[model samples]
Target: MFFNRRTPQSAARPTGRLRLGTAAVAVLGLGVLTACGGGSGCSSEAPDSTTIKDLVVDVLAEPDSLDPFYRNTAEAQRYYRLVYSSLLQWNEDGTLAPDLAAELPEVSKDRLTWTVKLREGVTFHDGSALTAADVVHTIEQAKDPENGAVWLAAMSYVESATAQGDDTVVLKLSEPYAYLDGKLAMLPIISDEDDYKPNATYATTGNGSGPYALASLKRGDALTLERNEDYYGEPMKFETITFKVVPEDASRIARLTNGDSHIVPDLPTDQVELVTKRNANAVTVESNVSRLFAYPSMKADRPTSNTDFRLAIAYAVDRQRIVDQVYSGAGRPNSTYLTYGTLHHDEDLGLAFGAEPDLAKAKEHLAASGVELDRKFNIIAVNDPQVTSAATILQSNLKDLGIESTVESQDVAGFYANLVSGDYDLILFDAPASTSTGFAPDYVNGGLNSQAANNFAKFADAEMDDLLDVALTAQGEEAQAEAWRAVQQRDVETQGNIQLVVSQSSQAWSKQLVGYEPSALLWLNTLRDVT
Candidate 1:
């Protein structure tokens, strides 16, 4: 699952200059390196002229696809970071950093148009030259549903995506969108030619203006990549690398421990004790991955349709207990939907949830709503171990309040279908991202829309709609900030479907893995220099 929080294009009347990607480097508070130096399509601390070595990585879920546009999940986006390029990228601190684009965009006085300059000598993985035409075609294709740009569907404000020159791209908007940079940050550009597959498969085949190429593919097992010798930036550290899919969390950790693999993600929380005791030489870096337990606003008639009911559930939930029992205190607590460390969080928004269980208070709300005890509900979640565990915990928590709950586990295909079909009651919805530090186009009206936030659930607020309208039409940091703050307060205080919690992101790596950042985005191309 890729992290959300990208801003939308529709709000800004984004004419499609360059919508930024998820500026997640500022996770909830963190932030991309995509402006120029196309070597691996990643954000780098420093540039090196020397050759880099090759390394393989292991992850929990096999990448869903290699098609950059359709790949919106964190894992897919991370992979694209290595293989694709974008106008602007996010730094680790959630700042609006540059990537494929040479410099920051020039927004017009009216905020309806934006101009971006391309980095010098950047080329697609196909060795095709980069130009204004490529950018426009790629972006327009993204808006086309048939093109499979999941990230693009969320951005609707772009009225025109055009090229100002061979190296400059201009976007004209119907409105003013602040998160355009964030939106572009999430979408790494690819060739618009028909040589590539618009409908890619999980078989994992991809090529772009990135640092690596698809060297090999083996469905349900592994993927091998070859470094792009002509990469636009510093050459990668690795000559050859493999992405081994180890679905079992324990096995992934075991491979790292046995030195069979260099890196692995989604390591089991339960096994932390054993790994620390056994792999003293290994380094475990904890990251804040954003996730929210969405009751999906589907129950328009049920007690959950009420904001009070949602808050009660949020209040009743002992997030600390989950941290203690399920996560072992490896993660941090979250308040706003944005990740930790980012700006704009209401630091003073005290937790409605208290220490200790409050099933009585929970039941009282249900009683007042007349929803009745023993009301059966379904909690849908992706098949991650932690998610499953969380669902079970919710089951028990709701049960304590006299509600009968069942846990439903499904793969991504089934999960999305169920979510969109409105078949389930509650789901583990990964909220679109927008943190204290920033937002990309994908998270806002420009990217994946809250229609899911609403359709699956139907949360409608006149105030929020008004804020979005004003924010979309306004310009300048002051105006946008004021509107955005109102939006954040509303979501944080009441309509918070995307919750806040530092995620238990695990990376089991042996000493052999040197440069790879163990990210949910699964960025490995950036680790090419690893010996």
Candidate 2:
């Protein structure tokens, strides 16, 4: 059994529907292996026209770096979707789906070993055959600590990734990981070659078995790819795709409005009106990934260190307002830690934020603690547009109760280190979708447990621990999913992350854009421009 932060999904309802599954961590010490995703953040609804295909997405920002290993940034992975292919692909419902590697794994009784056979006839853009060697190299490069691939943390379950034969890859695990197949779906296989460096030019032009090929790329401006003619699976409809880089929020909206580009991402809620009025055609709330959890100062003496205080904050933030004002009401206000479309989502649970607009109630609690309105608190946030906006909203919400707060912004690396090092009173989630499903641990006992150093909020509880312990140790999927759902509900009840808003984005596109999966990842394969 893999020692994962994710607990098994024991209580999954047997009704298999086509809804997007939540990108949730699986039962194991490390949690489910993290996957790749396109840039920016937020969730959305399904497109009105299923017939709409052929895509030329207007990416609001270019990747900081395209080197797959060096640029584990969400923007980088978003670019990779045009070229790379991972072992498995996750379904919208959070089940184990396949992209390159076909089907789920056959696990042993103790559930430590898995045998995965490659789908035949899959070829890279460079005409290289994707075999067990390709899978091996991808895993090896990711596991290298020097590479610093965030997904590698989840791959800790592997003891060896050796080939059983020419086409079959066998992974021996230290522990049972029922969600291993789901994890592999995110690890797009890299082509095995003599001179493989993440910095090489060919790296940007991927050599995988995905639905498309990297046709052209620039360092920070744009990336383009054409459909893989040799691809062994369903053909992409779009002949080519251009990922145009536009950084300024207003500029992205303008491009979509002018029809200069299609499929823009992360349109700020304030600008949705301009986009909708101009294009008269936009997709909002069509895709989503939950941004849940809270980070805290781990020092024993701090108020944030108290589970109740953190819970109180969770209860205070109006998630619906965040979704409505920040996201333009594209998505539901989710209180459970697990995201929508997951086996663990507790549909029965309401918002994590407690009663509405009662400053007296909030002040009463603070006064009971002998805390005065003049007391100061520091909030550290990633220096990004959305983070700034959210921080501003949080400031306004907290100030009504006379809480004195100041917001500090930092670059990406600074943000991660600062939060992990326990330097922030509050931190907003800024990482991309790759870490989405694997971010939340099912219970308190898992290493990826939400209160750990990386958990940002620094919260832990005995109830959370006991519940997770039972879920992980117990057998069967139904029992596990139920326990995981219960954990999400518990977190909401406790005001865990106090998620203010799950951002929803609007992408402008001509009905010509096709093959886009229309999920958070903005999967671009199986797409083509309608002539």
Candidate 3:
């Protein structure tokens, strides 16, 4: 299933001038160069050079589609961030900043209308000037339910967008949403001439207004992007950048070690030591992504439907142990759904499952639940190795609590179907909050509020809904924090969902590549500044 995608952290507006760093000496590895550098888009001729004009990056998978509105996968979002320009960009600290927008949006007194002024002189790759009309068209397309836009949740409150003039656009919302500005950062502004159908792949040929333009795409092999010379913002350093799909972790690391690829992202935790040993000079960065286990509350007949049973399950598992064993010490135990560094994360709320498992507490909660001793429930998970490992760990933990659970793994499509249908008692999945804004109202609403579209767990609490409403419309930071803290407390008390651990995502790049820094958002668009 397609999870929410992250964007780059906002930093000082990039000057776009290439800033090269010191190059690290290449170390030869023992393995003969395999599929990565042999015939898979990487050049084998230069095995130790660092001064290459063109850059080849190893991505885990090819994007499902180039159409921003059609796909929400990380791969698709990464490509979209590079090829398309949004009205606003996120600061490194998760604050909103203007990109295509000339300045901050002006909101009406009632908070229903937002007037946005577009930056002048910005042109798409096709050389058409970007105007309020383009923004209006993009919003209208996403707001249409028939389009099945992945980010439709963020704009559900948007009533309509109208262009007042060549450079100003006005948006009317059904209700006041405090996160509206932050949500708009994810809605990329596209060319008005571009037409994309729902679930259909759009062959992008340099049609965006971002730093890079699509040069060519060889599906399942490589995607070539050339620097957009007419880009209005900071100019890209590399004239050409090619993303090579290297599905295997070993192959991607090999490409980086052999100097065939400049960067490789989403490195497997198990392969971290191997990458470091092979290429000691490679630069590695890590950032945490939120992960959780959700119980299907709508399944009233299931044991997980009972709050006491859910709490019992929570107390049975050791989150820190899972972080160390399953994630190979590349994860942090999270108390709430939000990452630790996110805004409004309350340390006082403490760990929900505690530092370790409390078997006695688990037993007490289980006894109170009054579930049949012989009852058997299934824990469903996506067929990813890490997710499966986590599921197995939880399964073993529940067994110790005298509970029987069978772990079932399915592919992404099947897994999402089961979640939506509430066909399983428990589901181990990743539900990350928006990293760009570092906020949780949207996330809480999406996962816990009764009216949320993605509430696969079928969890509904009046207190949670009320707190979310207050948090979303609160005018000041203190008010918002208070509301969010209460919401977190209520989630813990009711056992809305058990947050297992926050996983650290790793990205490896050649030391020669500079001007790139890791952000919690994990957006690859920052590659535009790397030399």
Question: What Cα-based lDDT does every candidate model obtain?
Answer: 0.56, 0.54, 0.66
lDDT of 3 by residue, 1-531 (tens): 001112212112111111100000011111111212221213334233336578888887676568777655566766778888888876544356799999989999999999999989999988889999999888887777667566666777789999998999999988787678777777777888767566553544547888888898998799888888898888867778788988777788888887788777667655755765664232223333446565555577767778888888878887767777776765556556544444555654535566578999899998998988566778887655677888888889888998788998765556666666667788777543433323234556656766655556778778888887777777666776688788878877776777777665556666556444444454664554454
Write down the TM-score of every candidate: 0.78, 0.73, 0.80
After TM-score superposition, the amount by which residue 9's alpha carbon in candidate 3 deviates from its true location, in angstroms, is 21
Winner by TM-score:
3
Model 3 lDDT, residue 53, Cα: 70
Candidate 2 lDDT over 247-315, as tens digits, reads 787777777656566666565545545655563344443333435334556566566665555555555
Off by over 4 Å in 1: 1-54, 92-98, 144-148, 195-204, 269-287, 295-309, 332-335, 354-361, 368-375, 429-462, 469-482, 492-500, 515-531
Q: Which stretches of candidate 3 lie over 4 Å from their true place?
A: 1-50, 70-73, 93-95, 108-112, 123-129, 144-148, 173-176, 191-196, 201-207, 213-226, 269-274, 280-287, 295-303, 367-376, 431-441
TM-score of 3: 0.80
Question: lDDT by residue for model 1 over 1-531, one digit each (tens)?
Answer: 222223211112222222212223322211121112221222244323233254657766665667775545555655667777777765543356677888888889877888988888877766678888888887787776555466553345778988877988889887776556666766667666644456553236676777777888787787777888888777766677687878887677777677677666456545644654554122233223445456455445555666666655665566666656666654444444433423323333423344345777666655655554345777787777777776777777777766678888877767666555556667774431332123432243322134322233445566665665665555654665466566666665564463534444444454334343433132432253343
| Superposition error at 306 for model 2 (Å) | 4.2
